[model samples]
Target: MMVMVLMIASYSVGSIKVEAAEELDLQAESAIIVDAKTGKVLYEKQSDLKLPPASMTKMMTEYLVLEAISEGKIDWDTTTQVGDYAYGISADPVFSGIGLIQDKDYTVRELYEGMAIISDNATTITLAELVAGSESEFVKMMNDKAEEMGLPEYKFVNSTGLSNEDLGENYPEGTEPNADNLLSARSAALLAYHLINDYPEVLDYSSTMMSELDDQPLQNLNWMLPWEDNNFVPFHFEGVDGLKTGWTQEAGYCFTGTAKQGDRRLITVVMKTDSKEERFNQTKKLMEYGFSQFETTELFEAGYQIQDESTLSVEKGKEEQVELETSEAMEAMVKTGEEDLYELTYEINENNLNENGALTAPVEAGQVVGEAVLQYKGDNDYGYIGGIGTEQRVDLVTTTGVEKSNWFMLTMGAIGNFFSNIFTTVSDAVKGLFS
Candidate 1:
């Protein structure tokens, strides 16, 4: 698995990660600590191994539901009848899980809290069915979204993190709990990355230690919250906030947790620990180590002049050469104790240039002429493989004889522009089909 530092102007996904530094041992079978602002992995222990994520799988479910609401496909007041499958799981009353009544309808808002806070299996299935019409179909959507998010390793057999038992008689006879909700610690962190960053409001639900369902108390499963009693949890972290926790006889104790210390937010995923407190303890250790041990370093200044000799050769313009410079700065987060810093190198992408490999004479100021790609190598100089390195247009200009192209060349340029626009439109429409 790879981790990388990203410059945050805002949050978005769809990029690959590269490996960075290594850290101390963790008790969990698979664990990862990620810098939320930059998606940098501060620590890891078998993070790429596939393991049963249990209820932590619900993170993806929560994200999808929230995203649907954000996109206006669903509303807070939208309601769905509690079906047989959802009602059966709710009625089980095992592990203090919420019981939903058949022949009754529940709003999306209610189910969101139920699934997020208490990790209610029935409410999870309820929202799943409401979103996709059936559990099987909902599971498909989960996998699809996983692939879309670059986590092809995740496979969802059910919405809730049920394992170590049959899904009961409510569904088909062959359904078993925790069938294939396998995920890597890295994948889980990515899910949390999108969860907290894309839907910052989710913390509102996950951070709650308790809530009410039909006037009955609903307890949050996360043991790390800074709340009274902590249900006898060994420690109470000051900034620890919202996230999901899961466990089963087969999956053991697992938690996908997050916390904010100062301006930095960190995400930790610990899977298959010996007990609940252990998972929380290890996660706490990871976060504490991250905040105490690392700090951000500016690798490059924004709009830094990488090249200003004004010697870039022009192929067909009136001018013989044009000036070039970088358009954006790059930042990197590194360990605090370390003295050496990440190295930055710049290069121009040939493919980013226009026809004739020259500035169309009289180019406007600030016009993009080529691509400037920046790369990084850590203090060890081993290279940051998945570093989310920076890329920007190399803006440049020319002042005279801009309209030098003959009628034939100009006609072809116009025709090429027309075809490019058509292709882009078609591509965007196709992408919208899946979104």
Candidate 2:
């Protein structure tokens, strides 16, 4: 019996060790795993570290261009003029050009395609100029947007990722190189998050592995694109889609990848990896780990019914009770082994409830009142993950006055009014005499 007890204790300790190792495997040195729905950082490592983001900066460029088109500042078919500044930048050996002609016109859609699909440096500059009047001004807008999004580390000196030469046209020459267009992996991931959520159509372009422009096949620069027998491609991972990839000798391999299974979408970022293949492999491993270790569980349907209370009291009102309901659905992300550990709890705002204890007018059937918090009773440190909402609506049968009314009470009220009017008359006469 003693030996058996010792064996059981040893097995329990070993199992715990294995579970701890699995949990640690979910993180990387410079990585983040975020929920596409709530923008929650489910897992992270040095996620806020400021680093060079290379071509991934183009995600912002692409996003702003899309916003311009959607807001009517530019149209898909509208032609934008390519100026000398765009042409000059394109001529640089390090920059990727779409062969934009000076003072020539290309449709807004073409410029977007060049920038997004090919990561064309010149086309991006032209689009920025058209949308914001100049790249310098556009960089200011980019930085402003980053600030608006609560990202303090990002700065933008140029729309394209090309190195800025200080030959200052705005100031005297010999000024320092503008360090404006710099971004950390976290900021890039935020941009990707916004793009995927706001204008998902951008993925329609980013996900395309190949597109033909000017009679040339513009293959996607992201090595994750499916191809045969390349060390960069992961044979096991499927359903992987394009996002953006970046590399400069200064900033090592960086990639932001998004993958989906059913309604669940995940965003992964890897930065400063040693080699091109390592970036892809690391991303693949992270994505695989996420998909395999977790599953999405819908805690509530969007319009599902919440609890109904038989009696809710109204203050200083004729009615006695009000009904309660939920305003919106609740959902949660749960770890694989701890699905049964979560429970929803709720509360009502007694002050806002109507005379009949129902929710007051301007209340929709599916409006939220109080919140339902998910509590984890499980032993694991993984914890709980969901919120429930308390909601209320008018009882339609009562609102329509379909219920029986007291005829005896109405008769008594009429009789009381006759005597009260006589008493009011006598009191007024006596007051007039005194005056």
Best by lDDT: 1
Clashes of 2: 9
- Candidate 1 to truth, TM: 0.78
**186-256 per-residue lDDT for model 2 (tens digits):** 66767788888888988788777777656667777666666564654563356567588777666688788
* lDDT per residue as tens, model 1, 1-435: 111212212212233343334545678898887878767776777777899898998998898899889999898899888887677677765745676777777899888888888888888888988887887777778888887777635767777767525475444223454264788888898889888989999999998778887676778877778657846456567688869898877789999889887788888899999998898888888877777776665555555544333335553444556555445655555565342333333344455445654444544545554444334333343222123341322333222223355667668878998999999999999999999
Q: What is the lDDT of candidate 1?
A: 0.70
User: What C-alpha root-mean-square deviation, in Å, does candidate 1 show against the real structure?
Assistant: 12.1
Return the TM-score for each candidate structure. Answer: 0.78, 0.73
Query: Residue 346 in model 1: shift from native, Å?
Result: 3.0
Full-model lDDT for every candidate: 0.70, 0.62
